[model samples]
Target: MNEERAASEQEAVENDVVARVLASFENTPDARLRLVMTSLVRHLHAFLREVRLTETEWESAIAFLTAAGHITDDRRQEFILLSDVLGASMQTVAINNPVSGGATQATVFGPFFVDDAPHVERGGDIALGAVGEPAWVEGVVTDLRGDPVPGARIEVWEADEDGRYDVQYADARVGGRGYLYSGIDGRYAFWGLTPTPYPIPFDGPVGDLLTATARSPYRAPHLHFMVSAPGLRTLITHIFVRGGEYLDSDSVFGVKESLITDFVVQDAGTPTPDGRELGGRTWSRARFDIVLADSE
Candidate 1:
């Protein structure tokens, strides 16, 4: 009887801590903020109770998070990478951007995305100095109804054959990234290096976490795109290599079946869609049409 009473008292003490923390949010003016904070506190406390987490474990977690913040910089975003690997980034994208009406599905806006990518002429090359298997990418931008959306801006960025973005380089001269506007027929095309599977930046605390958890840090090869036109919903997505390694096990959990695309291999002599030859070198061709939702 005495032991049972002690157990009940302990349970009441834990509940009191949770209740007091939740009560602190009562005066928050923002409805959303209050709700979020209360829910976060409840869930976090529940998790701690369930795990019977010790002080050492909590301190270690704080240290790990501090290390993640310390390592983040312009070229590297450790928090975003942490969220990506935890599936939080993709979950937020899915919750906020539902793919109704055949609109393109959204994925993680990876850390490598840069604002103001240089504009390129239709069918121009984006792989300025990068070395990789040449690839010709052609696509059209249209509404869900298949009507052409002329003058839509298409921004594209990808890692090189070595699985590294241009920003990773010291000079970062806009290689493997560019933009183009769709023609009246909604057609746009460009040349770029075929994206190869690459590991996420695994040199810091996040890397240590992944290693400790025995998780791979590799992401599937893919071409990132942000297609936008006036009065239409902007699309942020990626066309992944159909047979690329890591598609089944993307560390960021960003792959969707619809995004997988065939990259047809061709001999160097094969004429490009625009009837251009590439100095007698072999290349691949891929096409990805985007369907945008109405912003309203």
Candidate 2:
């Protein structure tokens, strides 16, 4: 009887602690902020109680987060990597951006997106120094109803076959990133290096966490695209290689079935999509159509 009474008292104390913490948000002017804080407090306290988290474990977690912060810089983002590996980013995207009709599925924005990527002409080459087989990517932008969305700005970026983006290099002059606008037919095309599977920045705390959890760090080969039209919601997505490695085990959990595309290999001497002949080097081609949802 005495033990039961003590347990009841402990439960009451835990519940009171959560309540007091939630009450501290009462004066927050923003309703959304207050609600978010309250929910966070509730969940955090519940998790602590459920796991019986120890002070030492809490300190270790804090140290891990501190390490993540320390390793972040202009070239690398450990926090975003952390969020990606934990599947939080994908979950947040799914919660806020449910697809309507045949709109392309959304994926991670990744940590390497550059603002104001240089615009390129249709069929232009973006793989200036990328040392891989040339990949010709062509696409059309359309509304969910299949109407062409001419003049849509299509921003595209991808890592080389070596799995490195331009920003990863010290010179920052590496290629494989560019943008183009769809023509009257809603068509856009550019040349990029075929993407190859690469590990997320695996020299940091997130990598350490993944190793500790026995998780692979490889992400599937893919090309990132952010397409926007005047009356449509901007679409952030990736077109993954159909047979790419790590599709089933993407380190970031960013793959979608709808985004997998076949990268067809064209032998040497074959004519390109724009009618240029590939003399001695093999090339690849992929066609990915993007459909955007109507803006609210």
Candidate 3:
């Protein structure tokens, strides 16, 4: 009888703590804020209760997050990396962008995007200094009704064959990223490095967490794109290499079947789209037509 009474008392204390914390947000002026806070508190407390988290474990979590913050800067985003590995980024994307009307599916936006990326003309080259097989990427930007969406801005970036983004270089070189606009015919094309599979940075807290959990940090080979046009929902997505390894287990959960595409290989003497000589080096080509959805 005494043991049962003690257990009941513990349960009462836990419930009371959650209730008090939630009640404190009852007077919040913003209804959205109040709702968010209430849900957060309830879920957080429930997780703690379910896990029976100890003081030491909580301290460890705090320290881990602190380390992640310390290492973040203009070139690196440890928090987003953490979110990607935990599947939170993908979950948020799914909630915000649902599949409908044949529009392209949205995916996790990795942490490597930078503002003010160098601008390239249509059919221009984005592989300024990166080393890899030359890639010819061409596509059209259109709406659901199959009409051209002229002047859509397209931002593209990808890793080099070395599995490193341009920002990861110590010399601060810029390559493998540029922005272009669709022509009047909705067609856009560019020369870039062929997409390559690469591991996420594995030298920091996020990497440590992945190591601790026995998880892989390698993302599938893919080319990233962010397309925006007037009166359309901006799309952030990727074209994953078809039949590539790691597609089923991409570190960021960014792959969709619709995005998988063939990277067709061409011989050294093949005629290039822009007639640029490859000097006996083989290259690849991929076609990815985009469809934009109306913004609600």
Local accuracy by lDDT, each model: 0.91, 0.89, 0.94
Count: clashes, candidate 3: 0
Estimated TM-score per prediction? 0.96, 0.97, 0.98
Whose TM-score is greatest here? 3
Per-residue lDDT tens digits for candidate 2, residues 63-171, read 9999999999987888999999999999988977886888888999899988857878999888877678899999888898888999999988988778888888888
The best-first sequence of candidates by TM-score reads 3, 2, 1
Superior candidate under TM-score, 2 versus 3 = 3
TM-score of 1: 0.96
Residue 212 in model 2: lDDT? 92
Steric clash pairs (candidate 2): none
Weakest lDDT window of 10 consecutive positions for candidate 1: 268-277
* Residue pairs of candidate 1 with colliding backbone atoms: 268-281
The parts of candidate 3 lying over 4 Å away from their true place are none
Among all candidates shown, the one with the greatest lDDT: 3
